[model samples]
Target: MSTARDVPETTGITEPPRATGLTEPPRSAGVTEPPDTPGDPAPAGGVATAGDRARPGDAVRWRRLSRRMLVIHPIQEVVRSAPALIGLLFAGSSQGGHGHIWSLVGLAVMLVVGTLRWFTTTYRVTPQYVQVRKGLIRRRVLTVPRDRIRTVDVTSHVMHRLLGLARVEVGTGRSDKKDGGALKLDALYAPEVDRLREELLHRRPAAATAPSPRRDAAAEPTTPRPTDQPDPLPVPGNEPGTEIELAALRPAWIRYGPFTMSGLVTAGVLAGFVSRIASEGNVDLLRIAPVRQVVDRVGHEALWLQVAGAVAALAVFVAVASTFGYVLAFWRFRLTRTSGGTLHVTRGLITTRATTLEERRLRGIEVSEPLLLRASGGARLIAVATGLRVGHGAQRGGSMLLPPAPREEAVTVATRVLGTSGPVTAELVPHGRAALRRRFTRALAVCGAVTAVLLGLWRWAGLPAWTWQAALLVTVAALPVAADRYRSLGHTIVAGHLVTRWGTLVRRRVALDREGIIGWNIRRSFFQRRAGLATLTATTAAGRQGYSVWDVDLGEALHIADRAIPGLLAPFLLRAGQPSDGMDPDPGTDPIVTSPGA
Candidate 1:
C-alpha cells in the first residue's frame, strides 16, 4: 500500500486531464506521479485519481477570480445603484454648487471599492473544502466543506451577459447572519461556472470501479476477491446520468398572473411612486390636460359612481402592470431534471437565472391556493428543500416549482419531481371540534376588542354612530373566517408521506416525506392542554426545518410520531398501567401504542 509520503505536494499542471485513449506506465512503489504537462493529452480509458485533479501541498495555492471580474464588478455596482445615481444627480442639480463633483466622487469611490475587492479576493478548491480569502485591511477566509454544499445557483444580469460572465453561489443550509454564508464568486467565465456547478453537485454512481492491476497467481490465493468488497461512496462531478424536461412556460398560463396578488403589489408600488413624486413638488400628474379632462368629466357623477369608476381604473392598471411584470420574470421558464437527480430551473426574459437543486436535499412539496386562484382551480407549488433559506430576504432562494398552474398539473409536476407514484392528494384527517372552538374563541376576542375601541371613539371622540354598525359588520365577518380556518386544519399520512393542510384565504397542503423527519417536538400551551390538544412538530433538515400538525389530540400526536418513524419514539413511550414515573423502556421489545387510523 502507498503511504502519505509517496504523494506529491504539487502537480504543477496548467489544465485538467482529458481522455485521449493512451495509458501511462504504472509508477514504481514509492515514486510520486508526475503532473501532466500543459499540452499533454490524458490516457483514454484511464480515469484520473483525486490527486491528479487537486494537488495536495504544504500550503494550498490561492487562485484569483478571472481578470474579467475587474470590469464586470464595477459595471454591476453601477447598474445596481443607477436609480440612486439618478436621484443624486437630481439633488445635485437642485443644490447647484459642486453637485456634479459629488456624483463623480461617489462613482470614484465605487470604482475603487470594486477594484480593491477584485485584487484582494482569492479562492482555492481542495479535496475537503472550498476556501475563499479576501479583505485588504482585515483579511477574511471562508472555508466550506464539500459535503455540506447543497445548492449551486448561477445568475446573470444584462451586464454579465454582455461580458460573457456569470455569478456563482454555493449554499449550505446554514444562513450567515452577517454576509449570507459568504461562498459567492461574483464574476467568472460562464462555462467555468457550469463546470464548477457540476463539480460541486454531481454524485458519482456507486457501481463504478477503479482501475486495478492483476496480482501474481501465488499471492492471489491468500488475497481477498474484488467481488467481496463493499461498494465505494459516491464522488462529486463523476457522473451526470441523464437530463429530463419536467415543465416549461405555456402561453395560456399568462392569464393566471392577473388573479395573483402580484397585481396588487404592482399597483401599490405605482401608487407609492406617484405619492412620492407629488410630495417632492416636482410634477403633479393631476395637472396634465388629459388627467384634468377625465377629472372634470367625472366631477358631476354620483359620489358612489365616481368611487366605482376610480376603483375600476385602478384594477385595470394593476392587472396590466402585473401581467407585464409576470411575463418579464417568467417569460421562458423551464424546469429540467439533470443527471444525479438534480433539478434545474431557468427563467426570466431580461436577466435570466438558473438554479440547481439536488434531489436528496428535498424534504417535501407545498401546494398553495390563494382565494382567487383556488376559485379557478389553480395552485402554486414550492419545493421544501434544504439550502433554500440561505438569504434573509423573502425571495427564499428559488423554492418555486410551478407558478399558478392548474391544480391537477401542479400535482402531476410535483409527483414527477418527487419521484413518487402515490396520489399527491391524500385523505386528510380533520382536527376535530376542539380546534374549531379555539379558532372561534380567538376570532371573538379580536372582534370584541376592536368593537370596544370603536365604541370608545364613537362616544368620547365624537365619531359617527354609523361606526357602531361598521363594528357590528366587522364582528360578523370574523365568524366566516373562523369557520374557514377550522375547515382548513387537517393532516394525514399516506404512502410514506405526511400530508398537512391549513389556512383559509391562502390554503396550503404540504406533502412531506416520512424518512426526512429527523426529530419530533410535542408542544402544548395552557389552552391546548385544557382542550387535550397538542401540536406535533416534525423537524427535518429541509423545507422550513419544521412543520407542525396543529391541535391534534395528545394521544394521537404521540401515536403519529411513533407511527411515522417506528423505533424513534418507541423508547420514550410507556405502556398503560406500567408506571406514572418516567423511565427508559427496554430497547429490544418496546410496546408501541397504535390506533385504528395508525
Candidate 2:
C-alpha cells in the first residue's frame, strides 16, 4: 500500500554514456602531435573532440511497428465492419446471385488495403520530432515537433487486450481537421506502447549536463556502491505526485441519468430499430403476442387515458434503459489530479479506459445542469481544455470532470481544478429586463405559430379536435420555460475569469480564463437591436472556440468587453463629440448611441 511519496528517492544514479559513432577527420600532415587517437586527449585552447560532444541515442532512427500488426490489422478492419459484412452476406443470400460475389470482392479489397497499410507505414522518434511516413501511391511524411505534442493516449479493445497490444494516439490540441489532430500508431505491444508514452511525456531535467572530458575521473568518488543496498520502495502506479481523488461513480448518481434527454433519444432509436426490423422481415409487430395483449388491454381505456398510460410507460422504460447504460459505462469511474498537473480519469466496466489531461492545456471548466437533474440538485462538470476535443471517440468523456454529481460537489471540483479559491459558480451578472421581454415574446410567437398550424390542419386536413387542446397546453408550458431561460441568462467577471451562464433545459455555466480570450465578437440582430440588446462572444483556442454572453444590453456588452480585455475593444468604441484614446467617457452619456439598426 506504499504510495509514490512513501518511495525513497534514490540518488547518485549515473546515466549510461551515449554512443556518438563520430570520428574527427584525419589530421593534416603537420608539425606536432600524432593524429589524436580516439583515446588521445585534447588539442590546443582546450578544444574538445567530436567524440566528446557526440551524445549516443540522439540520432533519428526509423522503426517499423511490431510485426504482429500485420495480422491484427486485417482482423481489426474486419471486426470494425462486421455488422456491414453480415448485412452484405444476408443481402447476397437473399438476392441469390452476384451479391455473394460482391461481398467476397469487398472482403478482398479490405484485406488488400490492410496489407498495404501494414507494409507502407513507418514511424520514427527523434529528439526534435516524431515523424510518420505513410502512403502507397502518394508518398507523405508528417513530422510533429516534440514540444507541440500535447497528449499521448493509449487504447486497447478486447482483441488488443487478448493479444497484449495497444494503439497509441498522439494529439496536438488542434482540432481543425476530421482526424481530431492526432497521429496514430496502431497495434503496438502493450509494453512498447507504455514505454513510448513515457518517453514522449517524460520531462528532461534542466540541470542535466553533458559529460566533460576535462573532469578528473580519479577525483570522483571511487568507493564501490554496495550491491546489497535495499532498492527504493516501489511507487504505486496510481499514486503519482500529490494525487487527489475528486469523484467516483456511485449507485445514487445513476438516478441522474434518467433525467437527461439521452433516455428519450435512446427510446427513439430503439423504436426506429424495431420498426426497421419488422418492415424488413415483413413481420407485423402489433400482431406479436405481448404487443397484441398490451394493445387489447389499452384499447378498453379512454383515448386520453390510453395516451397518458403509453407515454408514462415509454418514459419509465427509457429511464430504466438510460440508468443501465450509465452504470455500464461508468461502473468504476474515478477522477484524480496528480501533482504533475495531469487529470487522470479511469472508467468503464467492460472496456476500462484511462485518459490523461494536462493542466496546462485546460482553459476553463463548465458546470452543466439539465432541467431534471438541476431540480434534483445534480450537475455535471466538464473541462474546457485545448487538446481534448469534445466529440472525438474515447475522448468524448475526456473533458468530463464529474458526471451527474451533486451541484455542490461539481462547484467544488471546478474550483479545485481551476486552481482558484474564488466563487467558481457565483456572482453572476444578470441581463436587463429587455432580455426577459424578448424571450417571452419569442416564446409567444412560437406558440402562436404552432396554434395556427394546428387550426389550419383541423379546418383543411380534418385533424382531430385534440390538436387544439394540445396547442393550448404547449403554449401554456412554453411561458414558464421562456421565463426560466431568461432567468438562466447571465455573465460575470471574477478573478481574471469570464463566466457565462445560459440555457434552460441544459443550463451551462462556463468559467473561462480571461487571458485565454483571443478576440471578441459583437452581434446584434434586427430584433436584438430594437430591444437594445446584443450578444458578445469570446473567441479562444480552446473549448468550442467561441462562447457567447447572450442578450445583454448593448452598452453593457461593450462595457463588459472593454473591462474583460481593455485595449482590444477600446479602439472600436465610439466616444462623444471627439474620438480620444486616453479620455474617459462621461458616465451619464451613452458613448455609442445610434439607431437600433445601426
Candidate 3:
C-alpha cells in the first residue's frame, strides 16, 4: 500500500523503466529530456512527459474511441414521447401548407443534427482530471478533478447489455442538484470502463506515481490523506470476503411493520376507501375505473362485488409491498471490506448507490426497535458514521446504512465492524408522575373534540350515527401515550458518547460518538417544562435533518449534557476532533462510563 506519496521517507523506491507505449510523442517532442536512466519517473506534483510530439497512433486511438459515440440522449429524451413527436410533425405540416414534406424534412433534420452533435461529444481522462468535450456548433470543454469525483458507477439496461456496453456515471460530491454530475460515458465496452476507472483512480503505473492527494482523500478519506504516499493497505484482519453476516432480521411483525412501504400503502388505501365510503352512499365495486364502469354498465351490485373489490385491492397492496420490500432490502445487496479498511456497500433499486467508507468514518453503532420488533427480539442495526451527510441540502456526502438484523446478530456484527465499543450510557428519563396526567388529559381532549365533530356532522348531513369513528378517535389519542409509556426510554452519557434507548413495544438503542457531534441544543416548551420534561438536540457535521434527538428527561438530559457537551463542542471550541487537535478532558465529572460497566 505504499503509494507514490508513501515513498519511503528514508530511501525512496526507484521508478520502473518507462513503458515503450508511454515514451513516443508528447515527451520526446522538445518538452524535456527523458530521465538519464530509462527508469525513475517523477512523483506526484513533479512534471513528467510521454515524449514530445503527438503520435499518429495516439491520434488513431483517440479517433477510434471518439467515433464510437452512438447518440446524444437528451435530444432523444426530449422527443421520445410518441405523441409529442407526432405533434411536432403535425404542427410543422400545418404551418407549412399541410404538406407531408415539411414534416419529413423536419424529422430528418432533427435526427441528422442530433447524430452529428453526438459524434462531437467526447470524454477523456488526463492524469489530473476528467476532460469532457462536447458541442457541434459551440464547442465546450469541462474538467472535473479526479479527487472531486466521488462515485464512479456503471450500469447496463437490456439494450446496453445487448450492445456489449455500459453507462458510466461520475458523481462529484454533487448529489444535491437534479442533474448533479458532469459527464457520462454510455455504451462503453466493459474493458474500457475498467480502464477508465483505473485511470481515474490513478491505478495505472504512470498514474501510480502521480496520484492526486485531493482525489485520494475524497474517494476514501479519514483524516487528510498524506500528501506524499501511496494508498495504504488494510490492517491484518479486515479484508475482502471476510464475510460479515448481517444482524438477523428483526421479528416478522417489526420487520414488516411501520417503515415497510406495504404498511404505508395499506394504510393509505384503507384511509382512502373509508373516506370514500363515508362520503358516498355506495363503494366502488372495483378500484379500476374502467372495470368499475363496465361492471356498472351491466348493472351488477351484489355481495360478491364487494368481496371481489376487497380481494383485488388486497392483491394490489401485496404486490406493491413485495416489490418495495425487495428493492429496499435486497437492492445491490453486497457486503465487502476492501484490503484497505474500507467498508464497501452498493445498494439501491432505481439509482444504484455505492459507498466506500473508511473504517475511521464510523462514529458509533445504532440498533433500532419498532414496537413489534422489540417484542420479537429483532433490531435494525446502523453504523453511525462521522462524515456522512444526511437529508436534502446536506453539506456533505455519505449515508447511514440500514440493514435489518436480529438482536443477537446485530450485537455480534457491531462487535466485528465497530471494534470493541461498550454500550452507551446516559441518564434515565422515565415518564414522571405528571406525564401520566398529561397523557390522560391529551386523550380526553381528543375524545371531546371527536364527539363534538361527530355530533355536528350527524346533525347537518343526516349521516348514519356510527360508534366506530368515535372508537377510532379514542384509540388514536391514547395510542401515543400508551406507546410512550411502553417505550419508557432512557439516555446515558459514557466515555465520550451518548447512548439512547426506548420503545416498549419495539425497543431501540442508539449510540452517538461525542467527537462526531456537531452542535447541541436544549429545548423546553412551557407545557413541557411544566411537565418537568425537555428535549435535547445533538448535531453533527453531516447536517441538521436527523442528527439530533427529540425528547428526553430534563434531569437526565442535563446530567448527560454535563458529561457529553464539552466533548461534543470541543471540536468547534478548539478544533478538537482533528486527529492531532487535542483538548483537556471534561472536568468535575466522573469518568464517562456506561451504567452497566460502572
Best candidate according to TM-score: 1
What is candidate 1's lDDT per residue for 318-385, written digit by digit as tens?
77886887687777887777646688777877777788888888888888888878888888888888
lDDT for each candidate structure: 0.69, 0.67, 0.49
Model 1 residue 247 lDDT score: 80
How would you order the candidates by TM-score, starting with the best?
Answer: 1, 2, 3
Clashes of each: 2, 1, 37
Give the per-residue lDDT digits (tens) of candidate 2, residues 498-518. Answer: 899999988989888888798
| Candidate 3: stretches off by over 4 Å | 1-83, 86-155, 164-259, 262-312, 319-332, 347-354, 358-415, 420-490, 493-496, 501-510, 543-545, 565-598
In model 1, the runs with Cα more than 4 Å from the true position are 1-67, 80-96, 175-178, 203-238, 390-396, 421-423, 571-598
Model 2 steric clash total: 1
TM-score-better candidate, 1 vs 3: 1
lDDT of 1: 0.69
Residue-wise C-alpha lDDT for candidate 3, range 1-598, written one tens digit per residue: 1101222212322221223343243332221111221121221111223321222111111211222334434345436544445666667666766546655656676777656755775554543455455567665555565545544555555445544555676545442334424356664665555445433432312253454433422332122233223234343531232223332233342343333333445557877977776555355557768977866765566778777887777666765674465455345544444444455555544444445554555677667665555555655555565334444311123343445445566566665565554653235446556555655566666776677777777879675677546655676757675557534656666656676665454465667777767666767777767776667777653222234333555655555665786554333232334322222344434366343553
TM-score attained by model 1: 0.77
User: Which prediction has the highest lDDT against the true structure?
Assistant: 1
